[model samples]
Target chain A: MSAVWSITKKELVSYFTSPIAYIVIAIFILLSGFFFYSLVWWFNTQAMQMAQNPYYFQQININQMVFAPLFHNLSIILLLMLPVVSMRLFSEEKKMGTEELLFTSPVSVIQIILGKYLAALIVLLAMLVLSAIPTIFTFVHGNPEPVPYLLGYLGLFLLGAAFLALGIFWSALTENQIVSAVLTFGTLLLFWVLSWAAYSARGLWQDVLNYLSFFEHFDGMTKGILDTSDLVYYLSFAFFGLFLTHSVIQFRRWR
Target chain B: MIETEQLTKKYGDLVAIQNLSFRVEEGRIWGLLGPNAAGKTTTMRILTGYLPATSGRASVAGYDVFEQAEAVKQSIGYLPETVPLYPEMTVESYLGFVAEIKKVPAARKKAAVDRAVQIAGLQSVRKRLIRNISRGYKQRTGIAQALIHNPRVVILDEPTIGLDPAQIKEIRDLIKSLKGEHTVMLSTHILAEVKEVCDGVVIINEGKLMASGSLEELARSFSQNDGVYLKLDRADGEVLNLFRQLPGLKEAALDGAEIRLEWPWGQDLRTQVLKLCLDKRLEIREMRSLAMNIEELYLRIVSGGMEQ
Candidate 1:
């Protein structure tokens, strides 16, 4: 475990030494800020008459207006940002031959895999933390409930971890970082599009295919209902991706 | 110490190496001599735990490379055909990372890295990023990484492959200096480099062990009946008659002032030749045995194509 952490620490340092980390963080924050401002402007314009309807407005909760869109807009922000962090995790090392040094070291294979995974996870965590500015800014306009924000962040974290695992698995499959990035984006886009298809289906297939939707789990989180099944599903998804990555590593060594 | 028995590697239908066997004892530099695709690098990879043998066993530093790989890795430092290095890192940081991965004691890591830097003559480029350094410096950095942990055995695959003559001499001297402290096995196709540096030569050809012995011993075994060239102040016919008078002298050929003579094995023809020259009062300017050099011995072993 210490060996794994050591490698993770080294990878994090490597990220900072390169320009990829700052670029990913900058793009992520810029996109998140763009989404937050767009949602605020749209909601404020729609509820402009609430300024004069004092009686019903006082009775209505302002938290819904302030925090609801913040939670809703996070998915798209992450969809674009996560791949930037995860794309170069294994692909660049393979291209540079640094993977040989890592693999042949005294450290176990699990340590090397988990180290790369954790480095990308840390970068993601940093991105999520940066996106919290909008949630904090909601308190200036109106008293927003923190529960939904907390729940939304949890769902994003899990989703990001799952996406990162998929990215890492793809990174291990090839030596070209651009190919890894494009393929990861295509895969995540496929998943992102699946929820709409599942929702639009009219038959029993809709019920069956909806389980494959990442958005369905986000819906439960935004509603502040943390379903145990959703948590289990995301955890299993991440573990399955990691398992495939391990198999890829083992196959490289054996064959 | 190192030993291999019937070690083989095949890529598709092409065998990279096959049925190779040899033993390298401690306290000597063994040169693995073969052509570019002659499986020298493949054999080194198997010994260093980087690749597995297709059909045999290789043990290095008393650990079976396939079965006890971690142990083999711990005991050996391997420099691959391409010096696997991180070009983005400085020399100090690169060696530090090597020490960290090799698990040098925390208390001694800095000192070990320092010693390796000094030994490989990397002090000048210690603070420079590896990408900024020249190929010679990069090669030395590779050597420093291999020597960081001070493993019992060091295996270098074509360590001096791309260096200029001066850089090659520097690296050769460094390899020679590693003699008593570590058992070193280096591979090269340059015959002169092997003769100049290696205490023992192991020649392979077409993925098989052609011969293994000391340079002189291999030369003697492969080139048993050698000739002697005598340059003296004597006419061709007189020297031919003098050479024929000697009983064990097989044949004599004259080329201007030089007389070449071949003799049977274990014959003392030198004394007889000297006596004849003295009797004829021939002024002998030079009389020396023409033993086979490394190039001839390597060709004789490799092109002879014998399995032994």
Candidate 2:
């Protein structure tokens, strides 16, 4: 356990010292701010229209109108950007031959994968925390219930963790960081776009694809409705990704 | 102590190494001598538990590498050929990370890291980022990481391939200084490194064990038949005949003023030749002994194995 934590701690330090940490954090905060302001501006426009014409009042829920879109857009940004942090987890180690040091150490393969994943998760969580400042501003000025923001943050975190695990698996699959990043993006994009297939498909197939899509699972929480099934889905996705990562690591030594 | 029995590793249809067996006693510096693609690195990887053998077995300090890998890894420190290092990390932090994962007790972790830093001579640049350091310092940092936990066996693959003479000597001296406290096994194609530091050697060619033994013993074994160079002041065809006349001298070749006396490696014909020289009243300016050094032994053994 200490071995795992030690690896995690080292990885975290590695992230903090590297320029990538600052780059990713700055990009995320800037993008989240952009998404937040856009949602606020659109909501203000609708409110003005309603004020000018009483019949134009759409009876829109503020949480659903502003917080939901902001949460969803931020999740998309996190999906696209977290790969930068996660792509180097195992890929860079293999390229630089540092995997030799890692595997030859007293730590186990599972420990290394978990350590790297946890470290990426922690960094991603920090980025999320910073990105949430805009949401906090909304809670203060927009006068919406904090429940949606809190729930949406939880949803975003789980979604980020699941994506990070997937990125870790791809990183372990290849030594090229570019390849890992591209594959992670493509895979996450596929998950992001699965709703399209669900929308066009027949009943049973649509239901299955909708259930499998990450956006579907994350949607319930972002809308301020907590579901055990959604949590189970993310936990399972993360576990499956981590399990595959472990197998890649184990097979790498044999090969 | 380290031991391997009939170890084999195959990549697809290609065998990286096969039927390899060797042993190193506790607290001895052993060298793994081989040419490129001779499986030196592969064998080290296996013994260090970075890779598993396709067949056979290896044990380090009473722990089977495959069965008790964590214990073996815990006890052995391995520096791969490329010197696995994180360029973004500082030398001290890298060693500290190694110490933590290597299970150096938390109480002694600082002391252990400090000892390794001192031993590897990384004090001045301990706080500098590894990428900002010179290649020599990077190599020293690699050595420091491997030695941080004071493991019983430290395996180094080509520890001094591209260093300057001074750095090579420093690394060699550092390895030599670990004599009784650590069982060190270093791999290299440089015979001079083995001659200078290793207590014993294991020579492999094309993934197969060719020869292995104590330094002097290995040299003498492969050097069974050698040539003696003789420079005579009264040098001529007559001297060549004089050299050939000595019984047990297999053949004689003339090169400028020197008469080359070819004989079996174990045979010492100096006394017989000196007596014959006195009888003939020949003025002997220089007589080279008919014994093989490590270079000749390595060339002969490697070439001999290649031919077979």
Candidate 3:
């Protein structure tokens, strides 16, 4: 609908025109390049040492040994950067009082949430594309399976979508951008680190906590396994975040 | 048209508006006058579909505010107290976005934005970012954004509250120009604005309606008698005594060179008072009817000096 497009375009314009987008992209690419270069360099040195012995039984596939770890490291980098990128989605609107125009407009609340969340998704997509430069060098310099790297990228995209949605949820809950960013980071960190606590637990509780961890599925996708359950988990997680955001905005109308 | 029946909005334990009701007929400029904390904005928010009322029913442009909110929103343009705007956007782009969200068709969006910019007199600063414009221009941009949709009903909350005198007059004239084509309701604490621009007014205080009628009707309903003021060159005790003899004279008081007298309701003692001054050889310096204006009526009503 035109209403959603209008808001989405406006939000995208705001994001790119300011220095926030440029700074976030710059930082994400810089960190991702460092990790990628280090991972590939380390993988090469390990491969060379193994070449010294022709009787080595285990094979070192460059995709898993190098590019998979690169994807995993870049996901961690996105975890730190995406929250800041999405922090202004609704918090800035509240700070600027533009929420009044939004609420009074004929546009539905879901359209607004979707529009803003999509714009953040676009920003993350841009970061992913730009950061893929170093990975492209991996293909030119060495033979890495394309499907595995693509799967890792897909997994990162899904995780980024869910993280950005949750960031927007936090942004809608407050008018302070820093508070939104901080809270988003805290919540996402809990999901990323929850698997660590599973190690100390036993039986069903451990399995439940491990399954709840976002990386549990992200790790599976990074290894080139396209599981439907993992895809459903990430999609449903993003939907639940979006649903809560829509409800928060609707509830404010009653106040 | 806009109508409400016993509309009430409560913020938890505090009642923002209580059992308030009023109507805005088609294509008329109406004023909602109240002091600070009088729930003017709260009422406007409900009508604009920005906030839901706690109780009772309200409708805008024939659509229920709560049930048919999307329809109501599509038919109304709202300018809030804070003048909601994206400071980063240009005036032209901001109006364009408003037009788009208000569902103006693709082919007509440019024309709609241009019309709104012209109506708000924002042509000179159409390309300027909202953050860089002056306060008056920003206010006009707010009005332009509200009117871009060309809704039948437009609600502006304190459109001239923080503007300079020149800006205030300009904005008032802009609102007055919409008398016949667009139904407008502007809330303000300035009584003179209502008298100059509004065809009818709804005065409230502490979230309750004090009076709702045209200027003359409200004044007449609050006053016991019509009043007049006369300044005579020789306004001595004898001059006051001569004026008291006029027919329909209810009460007469002389203070310095000014003599203000009250007469029976709907009585025009102007000719009689003039004839008496001519007969007594009293030179009249200044003479004007001091019919109870909106200022006194509002003070009297809000202060509970008049019976509701």
The C-alpha lDDT values of all candidates are 0.83, 0.89, 0.89
**Which ten residues in a row are the worst by lDDT in model 2 chain B?**
B218-227
Docking class of 2: medium
Q: What does candidate 1's lDDT look like per residue over A68-175, in tens digits?
A: 566667777777767777888888888877776666566777778898899889998888898777658677766667787688889889999999998999999999
Task: Categorize the docking of model 3.
Answer: medium
TM-scores for chain B, listed for all candidates: 0.87, 0.83, 0.89
Fraction of native Cα contacts reproduced by each candidate:
0.26, 0.87, 0.82
Indicate the residue-level lDDT of B38 in model 2. Answer: 92
Which pairs, if any, clash in model 3? none
Tens-digit lDDT track of model 2 for A1-255: 898899999898888888988999999999888888888889888888777766666575689888898888888898889889899999989999999999898888888988998899899889999887766766566578778778999999999999999999999999999999999999999998998899999989999999889999988897789999999999999999999999988887777
Best by TM-score: 3
The alpha-carbon lDDT assigned to residue A45 of candidate 1 equals 70
- Residue range with the least summed lDDT across 10 consecutive positions in model 1 chain A: A59-68
List the candidates' TM-scores in order: 0.89, 0.90, 0.94
